[model samples]
Target: MPSVDPAASSMYTNQAYNTTRTTDATSMDKNGFLRMLTAQMSNQDPTSGQDPNQYFQTISMMTEVEQMTNVATSQTAQLSRQKDTNAQAMLGHQVSYITQDPTTGASSTATGTVASVQFDDTKGPSLTMADGKTLVDPDSVTSIQ
Candidate 1:
């Protein structure tokens, strides 16, 4: 009977499976997860194969996360659209809102008619008064007439 050494086996002498870190440590995207799964599959031991059920479960989880992320994004976009619509509807109406002095750093309340609405991605909706000098934040509005 001939003895076969495990260390000299051809199955264990392949290259190491190294997956590069493309994303931050806290979170991994779907593409990163797929790349990692591929690497793992390619390097797994042949004799004792990985469970098919485990692979299916991991894929399912990834799919669920992707769907949830899409849903959240859609909800955010819908909310933004609704806000824009609401801000536009305030046109030709008088609104009372808090105002602050830039130099004196003093806060006061002011009333103005909504002349126009500006949609800013970073600032959201800003209402330009009839005077066109004052810019009012939609959130700062206290009363509408």
Candidate 2:
């Protein structure tokens, strides 16, 4: 067998075996974490096994994180539905809101009857006045009659 240089072998090992950097700068997401964990488990010395308790702890933490994420997503959807209901209830009701002139940059208070409500993913709930000209956000309404 030919003699191998230790420095070249070490460099080759680093180049071949090291984990790649993730796209995120601040933190590793779930997929990255799992890949890293799998690599560590696979490469650890078989003579002295890694602690089983550490794996259990990691699994328990991942479960808790996933559960919390699900709960938050559910709550957000619930809140959005509630807002839609509230906006719908305001239909045919007179509302007062502030408006600004496009030409002169002046603020004025205007009253209008809510003819329809629209839900936008980007802009949230908006009310269409009876006139069909003005669009008002439910949050912008100062008074509802």
Highest lDDT: which candidate? 1
For candidate 1, give the lDDT. Answer: 0.80
Candidate 2 lowest-lDDT run of ten: 9-18
Residue pairs whose backbone atoms clash in candidate 1 = none
**Clashing pairs in model 2?**
none
Per-residue alpha-carbon lDDT of candidate 1 for residues 64-121, written as tens digits (9 for 90 to 100) = 9999977876777677767777888899999999989999999999999999888654
What are the root-mean-square deviations of the candidates from the true structure over C-alphas?
20.2, 18.5
Q: Which segments of candidate 2 are over 4 A away from where they belong? A: 1-25, 102-106
TM values, all candidates: 0.78, 0.74
Find the candidate with the highest TM-score and give its number.
1
Worst 10 residues of 1 by lDDT: 10-19
Q: Please identify model 1 stretches exceeding 4 Å from their true place.
A: 1-26
Error of 1 at 21 (Å): 17
lDDT, candidate 2, 1-145, per-residue tens = 9999864442212111225744558787787889999999999999998889999999899889888966876776677667777888999999999988999999899999999887665455789999998899887788999
Question: How many backbone clashes does every candidate have?
Answer: 0, 0
